[model samples]
Target: MTTLVAIALVSCDGPTDAGAPDAERFEPSLTGSAHVPYSTSETVALLDEHTACTIDTYETKIDCVDSSGATVGRFGDKGEGPGEFLSPARVIRGPDGLIGFSDSSRRRFFVFTREGELVAEVPLHMLSIFVPISFSETTVLGAYTDGVGRAFFSAYMGDVMAAAEISLSTGDVVREWKPASVPEFPECEHGLPYYGFPAVGGAGDDTWVFMGCGPGGDTTMLRAPRYVAESPSDRDVEEYGDGLREFRRRIGADPDVSASVREFSETPRLYFLLRGQETFDGQGRLWISTRRGRMESSFIDVYDGVELVGTVEVRDRMIDFDLFDGTLAVLVERQVGPDDSDGVPDRGIDWYDLGEF
Candidate 1:
């Protein structure tokens, strides 16, 4: 039997009419200028106390900025070179203080020091691209897909994906583990045109993975599961396979139509949703963006380990966000006028002062 844990939900509706509430709401502290245009598909990571790095998908480089919001340095280019990136997927600060990035097009992973020096580049030819979680002198940790095609759709059916530790030198998998499961809605269909995938991040030896979907009162109890990576025996993997098979059976999806629908969901189209990106802070707190109502406002659920700490509803539609030190930075998108302009709207990055929430 599966046990569901009830998490207490706290709503911080940012300063009501009562002349500012006791809780501090998220307010814009910094905005990205034209020099460092924020990309809706890019991933941001804090390099240190004063610098934050983002994979500029449009510019095809890593943009590093200081606390003053000035472009300190930009590295990499659009080419098939050592430091260059072709179709860079995500950028993350590894556990070794080095910056690691994955390029799905090139089927390779690159590691660079904070000083913009490329140290290692390894070719990884896998069915699904794995997001780097952490790194050491010899190995790199990441969340990888074990099965192909329909297996990637397991998250939609409430199954825990696979993660592994790979050798940085030989490009070989060292060890793998499957985390615990969270609440999943097997009947939920893809209402939006484009859907968001599950994200994985690491802090020290611990790794966290989560999947988010739009707000629905009927599925309010659906929260992303966080698990500590552990070594498992052959029986463990076999049991997980059984659970996954059962989940797929419960969804009652035709195998052929399921593959077709998954392909269609990848088409580039305007998609609006209540849930956005998920990440972990330096303090190991899980921050997940979600919407509660049909309004434009969105809320972020902050969890310390597995316990729900607090929730804050922001006024803007959060596309993605990252936490560094005590500050919260978000990439937001707003609807623009002129119906002839298609679905492309104005987007920007906003830094927030998360004061004592």
Candidate 2:
């Protein structure tokens, strides 16, 4: 038997008041012009070119870093191993100092002790799942009716994100909820439009807010409607999915959009609008990597809710970003200076502190 609980959200103590300017709360200037010292001699290195995994490629295991840039811990390589990871989708630290990450491509969840010891692995139900990046320390007494499940015992999945509770002692999924298949966003059905990521939020309360993005992608700029699925129940979800499919068919059948729609459909990434990358702090904040601005240069935007607030700049094209423990960590590629004797990239990890912003 399953029971659904309705959840209500209280505004975060985040900077969202009338007197508080968005700039004051989320300052882009903190990252601009000024270059903060992120790496130091005391920084620890975890997984690098020498860590014995397939490290020749750029986007391979080069993505993981500690939240504070103080050290890099051991997350295994591409092959099968106790701590191994193949295309890690997301990583987070639970309250108990256990590090958890989901391998979307591998359909597994990994848990490790604070010292980088792998102790638990949980198999998942689907391969297309995008694992939720947030962690709650408390136990989940109920699954909220809203898109975001309520209670501390819950975790989320992506794209078709779901909220579920897994037993910490047994690694078993206690209760689960999945998004019923709705039609793809309508605008993409019509034009050769692109879509990236939908915005999502999880408050301290059980309220999870979700809004879809329409016809926006790595290159095109389009004003998209923001349709939200507030704290919806199982019955409400069924109805929403029906409405979504009808909208998709309507746009797909349009004669004017037939050609572009066909092309867009051919490229799954562009047509499906999988932003390719998504990040959330589990604290009601989200960031998406989208090509909606410049095709050649991908620009990342940060949001508190449905509102567009700021941008994350990767000036060197040699870095990526991740949200960790309420902070944003930037993985800057280790570069060799002209005077260095060894040609290998400098092995150092650094992360930006967003809380200070």
Candidate 3:
């Protein structure tokens, strides 16, 4: 079952009075950044202590680099031929040492080995907004966040859904995943929305979390609530958002969001607000970039499925962060203006030594 966990969050030993989650705040020491050819490295798979693979979507190539920032290898070409990619937008590591890459522009998905060997490729004409987190030679398994707004624009669907196993040949979702925790966007009905994602955590924009990593792309467990009822879930509503808010308040999140210059949550338009990202560690511990805190530095809440066991504070408003072999790689926004030189990269990846938990 998909779950918005209901677990007690205890504060870390030393920061009990900090108004943050009592979860232990693990300190991080800055390390050297991995050298990437471009600033478009978003999806990364940490291979080892000094080696990791990042997708340079700008050039449609996969780059593997070491701790010292030297390019160990580069693979993929921009073309329609075999082993070539038109626009590699997203990458996620799959089972059995395989990785999934989505070419958004060409409406194609590819599975490849770390060495850039093409394993499986599928042409999905309707694969516009659906990101393939797990796929095989046939099935395109993943989440589609746009489904939230689709039902609003088209005929309303009769059921609520978390994910879909889509087939371009059939032009429909052949199979689907349904979880009780998935938020419901009803059209005067009590059923679920057609293409909604889990939107509980104020953690960030990450839509879904994977269920269990196995041979097949089965990410039913990982989810973000894409849409909820017009009014926020009541205090008694114990869904994913409820659990996440409980955790946020414990971690020093200043509720009562300040009024903004533009449209706020009180508006009638569709809005899903969350900052930061979520990722799992080798030992199955879930680490999330904590937002809504009053501190200048960001905090990463480490969860053991059910409870807040630990937390890691970052030094900036991170774009994204990943951990590999006790090392943390944080993607930060670069300061660039119209007159900025080319040397001032648009993005920066900062490395850190993850302290003891």
Candidate 4:
């Protein structure tokens, strides 16, 4: 079934004020232990209380491990064929306890058993920005953009986005909802049109969305059937084309830097300043990664709905992270120069026993 919801996206000071009265703080262990190298895809999910699965986009395969940190198996490979993934964008454990991989380049959803066995690979009509928040055999409920055809919806400023529920067998959007309506851009002129790209994470049938364009704290977090969040990218506002009409009037159609960034800064959020991502705990609480400043580690904010419940300071630069069943799997960004086998740097997936949060 499809549900239509309306929400207003608001700018938050969550990350800016980690010392708030409601925020619980901690610094987790970041030692080099239980490292699964080259399997640090942007997403991770748990198959069981101990078994965690993630995509090695570097190797173009599924990487799973048991409770003892042993290689369960490396399933799938680089191919356009079934059970093969051309570009595995996101990986999640389904409600039925199966591993699901979203291959954006191939536009197919691959389903597999927790034991690394392939079940089915269904096609999807969505693009890279449309992230599957909730997955099942029949349909995939994706959060974030629904193809506004804008030059850039996020750091180039944003457009309010509508979430879609697509069919698995047919690869069609069967249902959808506008996740949020931004009465105003999350950060007006400063981080408004920067660093924030949409981030999606989930546990089982539940999915959570975060819009982090710049270093700005909590933009908006949304979920289906709906959430009170900052709309992804919107077309309803007067600043269509991210204020290009006025920008061209002022700067001669130069770039998509909204209209105000010229008077402020000419750029959105730089990649060097922000490498942001998100995930969810077993209880379906949201874990979003943000940085207070350019540093070695990441500061993660845990939100239960709109309430800031807890926060964690990691030891390494976190590329992406996920939490389920009291276990946390983080894709840590470690530079090892280069790899001849692949053109990317060496990556690692660090597993932690963060029991009972």
Best by lDDT: 4
After superposition, which runs of candidate 2 have C-alpha atoms over 4 Å from their true positions?
1-71, 75-89, 104-106, 125-130, 136-159, 179-184, 189-276, 279-283, 292-298, 318-320, 324-326, 332-350, 355-357
Instruction: After superposing candidate 1 on the true structure, give the runs of residues whose Cα lies further than 4 Å from its correct spot.
Output: 1-35, 38-40, 95-97, 146-159, 180-186, 189-276, 291-297, 305-307, 313-315, 334-347
- The models' CA-based lDDT, in order, is 0.52, 0.37, 0.49, 0.53
**Per-residue lDDT of 1-357 in model 1, one digit per residue for the tens?**
122222212221122223322223344344332224545353666665456677666677777776676776678778997777777756766655677877766878888876678888887757776767557777777665554334434333323445667787878778766533343323333322112223344333333333333332333333332111122323223333443454455457443344444443442211122222466665666676643321255556666654556665554555556676667765555544586267455544455566554
TM of each candidate vs. truth: 0.61, 0.48, 0.57, 0.65
* Cand. 2 Cα-lDDT: 0.37
Which residue segments of model 3 deviate by more than 4 Å?
1-17, 37-41, 95-97, 125-128, 134-141, 146-161, 164-175, 181-276, 290-298, 315-317, 334-346
Candidate 4, run of 10 with poorest lDDT: 224-233
The alpha-carbon lDDT assigned to residue 146 of candidate 4 equals 45
Model 4, span 1-357: residue lDDT tens: 222122222333223353456567776543223456564255666666566777765577777776566787777778887687776766777767888777656777777886667877777765545666558778777655544334223424444445677777777778755433233334544343322222344332222233433232333433211111233212113223434453354335555645553433433322121222455555656666553321355566676765667767665556566666656666665543445355444555666666455
lDDT of 4: 0.53
Candidate 4, residue 212: lDDT: 34
In model 2, the clashing pairs are 46-72, 139-153, 140-153, 146-231, 146-232, 148-208, 150-206, 195-273, 218-291, 219-291
Reference-based TM-score, model 1: 0.61
TM-score of 4: 0.65
For each of the candidates, the C-alpha root-mean-square deviation to the true structure, in angstroms, is 11.6, 13.7, 12.3, 9.5
- Candidate 2 vs candidate 3: the lDDT winner is 3
What's the distance in Å from true for residue 3, model 4?
A: 6.7
Cα lDDT of model 3 by residue, 1-357, tens digit: 243322222211112224334557677887766546554334565555555567776576887666676776789989988767776755655656566767755667777777778877667545234555445445666654444233222211322224566553443567655343433222422222223333223221133332211111222222211122343222112222333343345346654323421222332211111211355576766665533231235566666654556667666445456666688876554444576676453444567887575
Model 3 accuracy (lDDT, Cα): 0.49
